[model samples]
Target chain A: MLSKISFLSLMGPLRSVDIYQSLWLIIEGMVGILIVMLLIYLVVIWVNKIMNKIEMSIDKNR
Target chain B: MGSFSFITQALGEITLPMVIMWVIGILLIWLALAKDFEPALLLPMGFGAILVNIPHTGVLGDNGILQWLYHAGIEASEALPLLLFVGIGAMIDFGPLLSNPKMLFFGGAAQFGIFVTVLISVLLGFELKDALSIGVIGAADGPTAILVSQKLASNYKGAITVAAYSYMALVPIIQPFAIKLVTTEQERKIRMKYNPQGVSKTIKIIFPIAVTLIAGMIAPDSVGLVGMLMFGNLIRECGKLDSLSETAQGPLANIITIFLGITISFQMQARQFLSWGTVIAIFLGLFAFIFDTIGGVVVAKLMNIFLPEDKKINPMIGGAGISAFPMSARVIQKMALKEDCQNHIIMHAVGANVAGQIGSVVAGGIILSIAHGFGL
Candidate 1:
């Protein structure tokens, strides 16, 4: 963690926050999107699978 | 004696890295010619690979021939990929996706790889910008990856480019495992009917233009990629411009593809590209690609619940959501065939494939904007 902080400091500050702060924000944002997107996608796929099973049963009965 | 000694000294300047580059160069030629993965790209890439590897060839020596071509064709203007897009656009048919627009989600879902790769890259100690640039490999869109790499100025250009194309070639192998892992045998057998007749020619023509305008408005950063891609499609779908479209889809595309492939390989020499970072980048890239498949398929299945009785889609096409183009779509078709041979899901798969192409560019643009916003 100390080395990571020093590495960020060496990169110099171009944005509003310090380099370490900015790197943290960027990583946080990316992870947020990745997790949220995966959750949404998985939920959708599971729901679809359940519905398909019900639909198949109905069609067979008809 | 002095003159002879000077000449020998000049010969000694050739580096061992350059020798290794020569071997890799020959391998690319063999892969292109004998294996025939993508002959158009591999051949020129192989040739360029050889040219650049020669110790004192002066091609990339200082300001030599290959460098001139690289600068003029690729690096200077970034014209080749965009120009090639016109041909690709002209060659595509949007009828399938138009008939079933829900597959658009698949395209959007497949882009999960890029973001996932970025996260893993950061974990492995890569900087945010470089990781983002490298993650575009999972996008499965070569031009998009190049566009982002050039914009970000990531130091790992050669490895990034190879990772993008190599994963593309490996699609046939990678996608099946992904599809099967996420989907059960019962889910694989799910059938849905799609008819191309539902899509009118007017709609086909309008689809590309409308998507370009809407997508551009949403993500202005993607104008170059989305605009060029749509422009190609416009030429393809338009009733007129047969000659223009033909040129775009034919020699123009073939020539550009050759240059693009070779130039990428030229960047892949062992000296510049062989590093621990290279290994990490490839591993992270494969992670992105696999996740994208999961994301897309899962999204498609989720969308199925909202549909009325007859409208449920085969979830297999979800895997086709990545921007691997026709290859991902073909994989979907094969998976469906395995379950039920007569099930013709190619149309649905293609719809998702093309949509994935657009979705990837949009995601690439969004990443660029995010990076820019953070002032990185």
Candidate 2:
């Protein structure tokens, strides 16, 4: 984040809180979406596996 | 003599912008009717634009009906968009996405346009909040755009709504055009095998609940939007609430949509609508949309570098990862067919398209959370 600030110091968000805040928001938004989506993906995969196991055991009992 | 004077006074109240707004209103109506550009919303919005823009328009006056709807439906608690989201959530089927969870990556990737647009808007001298509103146009979901703009108290709410819905209708032309700029003919022709595993009813029911929890905890601000959307989806997947799901997806949704369209016109008053900010918002909205398309495509292309030949994805599906839903999914499917007759990637595209829906909602929540965090 500091790197982004200094790098953009010459041409970007340093002039106002709007730009600076937007800069941070953009970085966080992108990464935040990735993290959330990835977690959901993992959850889906885990659920599928767990569900499959439960069904398999049910079939074995039958 | 008094009646004649009253007529003259009314005529004298007409400004050039008011007449211009009437014409703009007509144009929106034409686009909705003649061109079939989101007729469900645009037709009412267009007519209401004229209704609100008329000189001494009653709708803009104290206690006007439109004003009441706007205040109650939108301003007070954002009930309209959130209610519409319940309908939207019920309408969506997450089976395709759950069977192929990796499509969630495309959903996340496709949001690139939003952040890019904000950076551009701020660079071009717009306020952060306004820029945030305009950037959400990339979300490609009108409800999320409206909700975010309302939350941020953006000045360009009307323009953002217009761009969000308009570009959503233009997905066929815009997605293809943007897809072409970054992808090759070969990439567009990449055929993905779609063998969807059976998605159990249990997983289907859990999916929305889990999404609500994940998104709400992280963004906290997204709780209302995600919660309502997931609630609708839960109604659909629960199997016991068939009647409730139908209501949410049908009459309830249709009714809210009608009011939501017309009520949005409250912001279209000529004095407010006619501005440099609106024009810039239109352009920025397009930029956000295009970048979103390109962003998804680029990520797919990057992913291709790591995957084996047989596992390569149709990069066009990446473009479908905006929240346009079945429209985005359908457009990519048609484009894929145009490139090769035998390639059928609709299922994959559908997965990504639905992922895009959740993606856009989460993105909106993320924006609100960040804004509140910064005291913006």
Candidate 3:
């Protein structure tokens, strides 16, 4: 009985990789990475823009 | 009579396994010296293996020098790899990453291979813990592989470390094969504009701290690994500690690396290393790297669909997302130059490459926490 339960548990994660499930997991992971990448992209752009703005204001004051 | 007896005893103690291990060790030494493949580590490892396997050497026994070093660095508490991380952290210049943080995504994307490999290993009848350790070879960071395997699959630690470091050294060869399979000449020639800008000093110092805090909060298990790495980076960026930074990157790193390499060979006794499982672990490690390359390239290709005409990445830069560091990034740049001499993607690739360093550690931590949660 314990062996049977253990076998079932082992099969649990495997089911998610049967065929379509594998594709979904790949897509999900890819999307998560993409989201993180996009966020980093946006933050960098925003920060650069703000820095440029501050530089321009300082130049104007001079 | 006593001297003759000692010689005879030594000769009599030689076994088939010891001979085989000695041969393997010699081969490792040849590869290190002749081929110049990770000589600093492999040479010491090979010599240590040879020394330990000699009959009646007692080099790997409880009070042996090798045993003492292994316990002090590896067995005692995982101090060796963490110390090496500080050196690695000191050497890394996050300016490129800061300039183009979008490359950070490729780091995350490349880690997909780790999970995919784990799933495959589990399906192939490996225990979940063992599979996780084998899969982490995809992290492409030698220390992370060592840390994970030591904790989860101590028995296979030698094989796992060998696989991880060997593949890392072969990044220049492996990455190109994978990149060519997925990318076209036109995509490879896609030249990214280089715009070098000076980042403020304050940002450089803050970057390591912020990353450590964020990563720690999200994956608490990774704090030790990430924290030590960030601490090294902090020493580098602090500006007032140039001498300390140099020490961390130079002597400190080299010394730890030598110790770590030699100590690891203590586990490479032939009886333990020569097995079907070792072969499988090696092949799985290669597959992990291949998948990591695929993951990076595929994600880059996917992103190109949404990006505008001018903003489309070369797609090959995605291959740089594995934690082989500057080597992977350099391979991408060389391929781009081969495609078109005018093309320059080194900076972008470096950004992605550095991001991979952090991504790999975080991924290792996440895997550790998940394995713990599973009660494995």
Candidate 4:
């Protein structure tokens, strides 16, 4: 039972071996690149909000 | 039996291979000193190579200083490059990236070459792990390449490190050619406007910490590399540790760089360093860089299709996405100015260039994790 459970858990990580492992790696690489792009996009949006707020505060003071 | 016989014996040991290695070492030194190419690293590496290759020196043999340095710093643990990241982090200012966040996508896009090279290398008959190490040279990041090669392909570490640093130094020459090949004359002339905005000190302090936590959580194996780098940036941003930041960026960085360069030469012994595999690895490294340039430009061109006219990015700035940092950025700027004398794209190029730095590290971490998962 324990071995079966472990095997099931391994499925997601093991997805990197679907076809030839190298080909899987290429797919994994693309996914990783996309994740980084998403993170950057989110961070940029958040920073823009903060900067806009700060600009507004500075304008009020002036 | 005589002293004369001892001199003759020493001369006899100098084979054609040793002579060839010596000549290569001399050329490296010449490139560093005369051609002004990456002198900080190549000079030490070149001198170390000559020192080790001299007959009977045994500098790369058991109990030798170079061997000890290699074992202590590089072979024993992956500490040197990770520690060097701290200094690198301290030197970086994330302001440009923050001001122009869209440039971060270029960083992600630029990593296209790393994956492409992995597939090509496998097709060429390299094992998956070895191919991954070779592919990482596309990251355009010397430390990350060294880290990956040391972990995954220790056999080819010397060739990969030399190729990584050599190509990094050659970015000024290589990137322009790659850029010219893919880009139109009109695309190169597109001017990007730089809006100077002030990023608050509080956000600057928060940025490194946030990146460290987020990147570490996403890729656990990358914690050491990304964490140390963010720590260095934190020291610079915190405003309370100016002296520490200075030391981290200056003396600490210099000492590690010198040790790292000379120690790497221990692997450059003629027997292992001079091989068909090494030659292929060097050429593949160049191919990876070319692919990275294409990836960045293609992504930018793709994005242009959706955006309004004035806000569109200059596609040439896409080439700056490689992790050569300011050098790649400067090349794009120079090319742009040459095409249209009034155009200034340095700020936008720098934003993408810095993003490439972080993007490369993240990609390296992801690759490391995937390689580990396969138990390679």
Q: How do the predictions measure up, each by TM-score?
A: 0.82, 0.95, 0.90, 0.91
| Model 2 chain B lowest lDDT segment of ten | B1-10
What TM-score is obtained for chain B in each of the predicted models? Answer: 0.92, 0.98, 0.97, 0.96
Ranking by lDDT: 2, 4, 3, 1
The better-scoring model by DockQ among 2 and 3 is: 2
Measured by TM-score, how close is model 4 to the native structure?
A: 0.91
Query: Which parts of model 1 are misplaced by more than 4 Å?
Result: A1-62, B1-11, B195-197, B269-271, B305-310
Candidate 2 CAPRI-style tier: acceptable
> For residues B125-217, could you state the per-residue lDDT of candidate 2 as single tens digits?
777788889999999999999999999999999999999999999999999999999989999999888877668889998999999999988
Quality of model 3 by C-alpha lDDT: 0.82
Candidate 4: stretches off by over 4 Å: A1-19, A51-62, B1-5
After TM-score superposition, what is the CA distance of residue B250 in candidate 2 from its true location, in Å? 1.2
Docking category of candidate 4: incorrect
Worst 10 residues of 4 chain B by lDDT: B1-10
| Range of the 10 consecutive residues with the lowest summed lDDT in candidate 1 chain B | B195-204
The list of candidate 2 runs beyond 4 A from truth reads: A1-20, B1-3
Candidate lDDT values, in order: 0.72, 0.91, 0.82, 0.83
Residue B45, model 2: Cα distance from true site in angstroms:
0.7
What fraction of the reference interface contacts is present in each model, in order? 0.01, 0.67, 0.19, 0.36
Cα distance off (Å), candidate 4, residue B132: 0.8
